[model samples]
Target: MEFFTIKPCKTQAAYVVEPKKPLHLDLKALKVPFDITARTPVLMAMRIDGVDVSLYPSGKMLIQCDEPECIAKKVWGEVA
Candidate 1:
């Protein structure tokens, strides 16, 4: 599990989505816990079923095995 990029906005966090490969299925985003603020930028890249999807900030990501355990993975991240 790698990361893309993390950007922030005034009211909401900004996220960029760029899949390493083209994906058209369901993915699971794990919102891991972190000390950073909720509004902080988070970059993440998930390999779901051999596919990657770019998740925008505040956007929703599908989960794989089980859901993440915290807010860290919940927030959207940029896809690099």
Candidate 2:
């Protein structure tokens, strides 16, 4: 199955990536290298390459950058 579906954001230079099914992620336990700017029970916001990235427990991500697809691939890796 496809790991995620990607679409460009209508109001910004960004992309939204979402999994086919909900993914329960522990925001407090994520080991991402980016500096997290905000955190809550349901969301984690970080900065990467001078842009904003918002992660959700439901396997949805909003990435604002010039190459969002590339960043998404690197973040989630090769999922079958």
Candidate 3:
């Protein structure tokens, strides 16, 4: 598993990681109250079934914060 991030630039909100892809992510430091397409966003990589989630940072930067579990569940359908 590997982490994939999409730095939000007022244009992109989140990266649609194709289904079945292994993307590792730790949403313990993501911003909050961020509109789906308003605040900056990051796309970490991970597998659906089960695998090691590898973390990787994005190129763009912004006011970083922990990714909320509630928001993750609503957006990604799951949170880690």
Those runs of model 3 whose alpha carbons end farther than 4 Å from true positions after fitting are 1-67, 78-80
lDDT of 2: 0.75
Q: In candidate 3, residue 64 scores what lDDT?
A: 26
Give the lDDT ranking, best first. 2, 1, 3
Candidate 3, overall lDDT? 0.32
lDDT of 2 by residue, 1-80 (tens): 24467888888678898877777888877777777899887998887778788888876889987677766665565221
* lDDT, residue 49, model 1: 40
What TM-score does structure 1 among the candidates reach? 0.23
TM-score-best of 1 and 2: 2
Cα lDDT tens digits, model 3, 6-70, are 33335444332222344344444543333333222254333322221222332212222234222
**Model 3: ten consecutive residues of lowest lDDT:** 51-60
Per-model CA lDDT versus the true structure = 0.34, 0.75, 0.32
How close is every model to the real structure, measured as TM-score? Answer: 0.23, 0.75, 0.19
Quote the positional error of residue 80 for candidate 3 in Å: 13
Residue 69 local lDDT, model 1: 19
Which candidate leads in lDDT? 2
Model 2 RMSD to the real structure? 2.9
lDDT of 1 at 23: 34
TM-score of 2: 0.75
